[model samples]
Target: MKKNLLMLFTLFIALFTITSVKADDKPVKNNYRIASDSLFAPFEFQNSEKKYVGIDVDLLNAIAKTEKFNISMDFVGFQTAVDQTQAGHADGMIAGMSITDERKNVFDFSDPYFTANATIAVKKGTKNITSYKSLKDKTVGVKNGTASQEFITKNKDKYGYKVKVFDAADTMYASLGTGSIDAFMDDEPVVKYAILQGQKFETPIKPEKIGEYGFAVKKGTNPELISMFNAGLAKIKANGKYDKIVAKYMGNEASDDKKVDESTMIGIIKNNWEQLASGLGYTIALTLISFVLALIVGIIFGLFSVSPSKFLRGFTKVYVDLVRGVPLMVLAIFIFYGIPNLIESITGHTSPLNDFAAGVIALTLNASAYIAEIVRGGVNSVPTGQMEASRSLGVSYVKTMQRVILPQAVKITIPSLVNQFIISLKDTTIISAIGLIELLQTGKIIVARNFQSFKVYGLIAIIYLIVILALTIFARRLERNMK
Candidate 1:
């Protein structure tokens, strides 16, 4: 009986030891956040269902699956993706990003998954642009932060062409269509995809292999992720999945579906109402939330401007001046991209602000500055005697200011506040620079897919006009009520 008990005890110890070792040896599971370009078609783009589908999307997802890893993808724009990865907000990026020497300094790239050439595309049937020399005296367009832009800018002196940099490919393509730019340089596959989708453009110049596309992580970070990507990519390629994904997007078979006439305003709205509504919702939400927060903060600062303490007043003045002095777009970028980078560098910790939070903070700061001035102006407009009378009647300073001064100041500031709200609403469009899909960005996306810039932009303008008009009427009614 004693021998049997000892044997059972030994068996139990062996099982426990084996379990502990296996647990320690097992790889930790992590869901990595990956970023990619929002509108690079055939590489990444929204389908009719509003779902993102493309070669890059499929390829990355396949690799993740094959490697038994998890990932969440953010379809931010190319420049924004690079910013996010550098800021450590994203674990990696696979946005058809070119692996270049300059980029190598900042990013550790996986093995090249695809190679693409930069090509000069001119409006169709334009026989003049046969070579780089033929581009002399022509205005050439390139998307911001692209290898094509780098190449074009470097050779612009020799080519004798003026360079126009667009923040997005949609605008660049639109410029080419409207003849604002004589030609544009873009990835060959992107240009081909655009042509396939009915873009009236032709590449006359021979394409130059700028660089091969690779999955990248920030240097000295996520080395394991790079290894996993390389391994999975090889597996996919070996098993023929890579070729299948490539063929799915870049197949020789042209689409046979009839093109809808989205040129008409009504047609454009009909086709894009879902996206428009989603965008409008975000715009309104951002505007309302930011304005409310700004109002609260601005009122406090405005009171500071009129405070008994000279220091408080001076602080308020400086803050208002500082924020108001900066452009809204710049503020958005700084908050969204710059702040994260700053935080990481100083603390060695990654802190990334999402688009919504960053946009609200930027808009609030900007609007608060103006709102503070309005409040100051309103408070000053009130009679000084009222404050004295309230204080003489045994009211404390806070009570007197709240009951006597602020009530009247609010009435005086109503119109200005309403105007500021309208401005803030319009300003939300600028927040799209940071990749928030507000109304204007939505319109840009639609224009990219359909190439109907005029109709889409016109509709967006009309929507803004209607909303502003309604707000103006509401403000008038509110003023009358207060009177």
Candidate 2:
């Protein structure tokens, strides 16, 4: 009887173990991912320790805890973060962005996360231009590829001012601090936050309503995720977490009523936008001029490198190596500032060329180096046997390259050549460092006077994306043809 009872107990234990193993075979849950660009300040910005930490991050962390969903965060450029979400590489994105009607057609967005009035920041007590109207004919800076660019570009004729554009707000603001820009536009709350954090700039330039910031996800994504996010956002707002985050960043002006000074802010917007609009013409012109120069220089240098003469080949090779070795920014500065100084010293006269010419010269010279490589690679791609065959047929060397080797080489290099065109297109921004008016420089002047970071940058981003996308498509087609 004891042996039978022992056997029964062992059988019961084995059955329970089998049941538990079956339950464990169910699928495990995964945390969702979100992407953001660390640009919007207070809401988002890189901390002193050089880590991305902001109200946006803090809020998201709180939401994750409450929602009980795994949350992963990744940093990319704001627009790029949107692309990742659209591509399903990320579950969502939340930087301080506006929910413009145009964007609504493409992506799902959360309700307005926060509101900020646009205001301008300028040096403490500089006078020639107090407001946007006064900015006429004065050099102004803006960050390229933002709503500010579009607004200024559309209204320059109406405003009668000149604008310069730069690629980044940090760079644009840097120029303003150095007095390179008269003023810039930005969100009032954000600018105030920057000022509290140690930015030295003149008081209230004026204020303008640019737009509000919103969170975004890919259009037609898992609605459940968006639902959960919206719910969590509501939870935070009701529990006072949102106000607490805002108050923590409010500095001494923690009082709820410190509105962005309107009159001063508006004046700055008028100045910066007027300047930005005036610069649109020159921006397009620079791209055309630099592109033409890059093409001519690229083709000539490429042919020289392909020449049979060791002297021609050696000279072109050195030129390509030297230019390609230097960064585009360094070359732009040298051409714009260094060359003119050298010329003045030798001739005892300042540069006779206009600012535009200096810019064109710098950008093209740098571009030619890469163009030369692209051109040379194309010429060399033709099998050596083809050149030998042409020579055997008694064709002149130049004729053989032009008719037989060159044609085939060009086909192979078309893609890189187009890329060179795009690079030259962007290289125009580098001209701003030398004080030349272009798309990017225009952005800085506007930002200086108006702190509409989202509205301003959103304008420039769309313009550049359009141009870059077109060039990319062209390159793709060219590659297909060659293949």
Candidate 3:
């Protein structure tokens, strides 16, 4: 009787275990992934407490809570977030993205949550730049791809001003302060936030035509996600959560002041140490890897250019000329965004090049051309007698070039090579075009959050100077050792 009773209990336990396992294996119903800008103040920017707390952040969280769905937020930059959403890597985006007809073709958007307008601002105490009429014969700045750019481009002819498009707000503001640009246009809230944070700028023009901000997803991919977002947003608004979020970040500003003051440069650096350090690491890694690749390519092509065969020399010439002719910025954009599309068109395969890898490859290609010329000059600078002596010593042509000529050429070109590396390091700033944030981009992110462009840029300039100086010192030591 005891044995029979134990067997029954074991059977019941097995059934229960099977039922629990099946329940656990059920798929998650409505998990959505979203992307937002890393810094776009009051809409989305990191606070002094190091938390990503702002209007967008709070609103998204509230929406997810009301909808009973899990959300994962990826705080990549604006361009990257758009790229990922279009590629279907993220379910949606809500980075204070302005809704426009052009964007609607590629992305489906939720209901408009906010509206904003572009405004013209200039440094204080500037002369005769009060209105659009005064902007004639002046150079104005606008952020790339923004409505401000469109506004400036459309009206530039009428205003008789040249427009310069910048990638980031901080850079644009810096240009205004330094007189590189006479005036600039950006969103009213952004400019107001900058002023509130002590940026020495004044908005002389009223807000321009208004645009609605919306959450977006890739077109025709996730209708359910959009529905959920819209439903939750409506619910949150009805329940007063939306109003609270807006007022929390946008109102009672003096009570919740956290902008960095003039004396807090050190504090800003200390507060954002992790971001800066990560950026430095990426910059160093990019520099070292790209330099190494450039060195190898330069040496090979340098040899080819100096080869006895006419065909080999011609090949090297065409390559060097073509690569050198194209601008680095253009080449980088092509490699990062265009290559995948080109590949897909030709082969019907969607292989997007890794952003960092594309950057390194572009840098390597550009630097290699210049380095090839340096290497050739270095080799030619060597006496012809050296190669003759090596050949007379029964050394093969290949061996003589490698064992006798190349080493001397490399040593002679060491200073130039180091300089080229430094140039390459600085050129990494342009790679931010394709969304790889190195040191400069990192500083831009911090400045966008804190609105302390002068201090942040000053600190970035120091960091860059220190790094290049260290490289210069090392090069000098190397030259001395060689001597």
Q: Which digits, one per residue and each the tens of the lDDT, describe model 2 over residues 44-88?
A: 654422345677887888776766667787654455466456545
Separate clash counts for every candidate:
0, 57, 0
Candidate 1 vs candidate 3: which has greater lDDT?
1
After superposition, the stretches of candidate 3 with alpha carbons farther than 4 Å from their true spots are 1-33, 68-72, 83-91, 120-141, 152-164, 175-184, 200-209, 254-262, 346-349
Q: Rank the candidates by lDDT, best first.
A: 1, 3, 2
lDDT (10s digit) by residue, model 3, range 1-483:
999999999999999998875454332456677878876777777676656767888888888787667888867778778876775557789888889999999999999988878899988877688789999999999987777788889988998999999977778888888889999998887777778776798987777965888989889766766776788889988989898888776664712336544347878777887888888888989988999999999988988888889998899899899999999989997887677767767887557677799989999999999988888889999999999999899999899998889889878999999999999999988887677878888887777777678788788899899999999999999988876
Residue-level lDDT of model 1, residues 1-483, one tens digit each, is 999999999999999998875454332557899998888888988765567888999999999898888999988788878988988888999898989999999999999999979999998999888999999999999988889988999999997999999988888898898899999999998888888888899998889999899999999988878878888899999999999998887876533212555757887877779999999999999999999999999999999999889999999999999999999999999999899888878998888888999999999999999999999999999999999898889999888888899999999999999999999999998998887889998887776666678778989999999999999999999999999
Write out the backbone clash pairs for model 1: none
Worst 10 residues of 1 by lDDT: 252-261
* Residue 173 CA displacement from its true place in model 3, Å: 3.5
Best candidate, lDDT-wise? Answer: 1
Number of the top candidate by TM-score?
A: 1
Model 1's lDDT to the true fold? 0.89
